[model samples]
Target: MKKNLSISARLTLVMILLLAVIYPLLIAAVGKLTPGKGKGETISVNGKVVGYERIGQKFTADIYFQGRPSAVDYNAAGSAGSNKGPSNPGYLQLVQNRIDSFLAHNPGVTKEQIPSDLVTASGSGLDPHISPDAARIQIKRVASSRGISMQKVTELVQAHIVQPVFGPAYVHVLKLNVALDEIKH
Candidate 1:
């Protein structure tokens, strides 16, 4: 009976050790095989790397398009919404502040033309894309800055508007930036 009990204990210990070693190796192998968003490559301009799909950076220049609003100050590890419900007083205040800033920078734009994505932070603070309307709204400013015709800039924006890979939605910011870089050259 003692020998039988020792055998059972040894079997359990071996199983535990096997799991401890194999489980992590399996997980690591799967992680390596998985294709993570923004892990493939970054879009470069004139051999200068600009940004990654996972990060949201501020684009203040008039010659470039802007991305969606960020809540965690564009920190990837801290990605999250402001958690303010639509009715929250803080939400309204923040929206108003964002609107004010947008107007300040885009002095030529009217209130009705501002895109909703520009004034509201995305659920994930690291959104690297903006709505097509947002890109369109910035065309005048970008054209003026680059001294290009509005028609040319508009055509470029339309060309960069990426239709949803699977459906009807689209992403416009990355393509817009790439086009803007081309215009610079």
Candidate 2:
């Protein structure tokens, strides 16, 4: 028993050193090779920093295209999902409320036309990208609110679609909103 205890203690010490120290160092080293070096990729406009590329922003105004409903209310400091399953009554009720709110803001848009991404919060609660379809669905409301033609709004949404190498296309909501502000007409 004495020998077994000694072995266990040594193994635990080795694991702690390996996982708690060395692993983090290795990850940081790898992160240095990526864009923003794992700190965050900032989106700037006219030399003013607006937001991070990976963190979503809340745009509730009718003139702006809203991003996903954030479980953390787009608070980067407290990123998380609702963690409620689909069958959970509270979760369903929350989604229903979101759908209703979206319809109220976007007149002439049917519930079926609204994409799920527009109504559901992402797992991270900080996803910056929304599906192209999600952005498209909002063009009508945004154009009307901004007094721009739907064609111009659609063109802007199409220009912002990012076809990543590994996943489906998505548009950065912050980028889109910034461009929307730049439109003189």
Candidate 3:
């Protein structure tokens, strides 16, 4: 029994050193090699940082492409979803409210045409990307609002499509909106 107790103590110490200490250091080292070097990737325009590319930003204006709904209101520090299931009344009501608001701003968009991503917050609540369908659905509104042709907006959305190996293409909404601002009508 005494030998077993000693073995457990040594195991615990090893685990603490490996997981608690080494693991975090390893992660930080890896982060240092990334684009932001531990900070998130920032999108800049005119030598000024507008927003992070990996985190969502709230863009309610018709002239900008909107991202996924965020339960935490785009607060990166408190990234989280609503934690409500699909059948829950509150969740359904929330989705309906989003749909209504989206339609109100997007004049001709139908309820069916609205992508699920636009009405439902992602699990992390900080998704900067949305389905290409979601971005395309808003092109008309954005084009009209910016006084640019729909063809140009379509080209922008097509240019930003990110095709992952396992799923359909998605567009980074923040990048799209930044490009929108750069376009001269």
lDDT of each: 0.77, 0.90, 0.88
**lDDT for position 31 in model 3:** 99
Minimum summed lDDT over a 10-residue window in model 3 is located at 176-185
Q: Write the per-residue lDDT of candidate 2 for residues 1-185, one digit (tens) a residue.
A: 99999999999999999999999999999988989897878888889888987788998899998889888999898889988887999889989998998888888988888888888889989898899999999999999988989999999999999998999999999999999999963
Best by TM-score: 3
Per-model TM-score versus the true fold = 0.75, 0.82, 0.86
Can you write out model 1's per-residue Cα lDDT over 89-185, one digit (the tens) per residue? 9799989998888787777888799878889988888777777788888888888878989999889888877786686444557656777677667
Q: Which one wins by TM-score: 1 or 2? A: 2
Candidate 1: C-alpha lDDT: 0.77
Pairs with steric clashes in candidate 1: none
Ranking of models by lDDT: 2, 3, 1
Point out where model 3 deviates above 4 Å.
1-7
Model 1 stretches astray by more than 4 angstroms: 1-40, 46-48, 165-168
Better of 1 and 3 by TM-score: 3
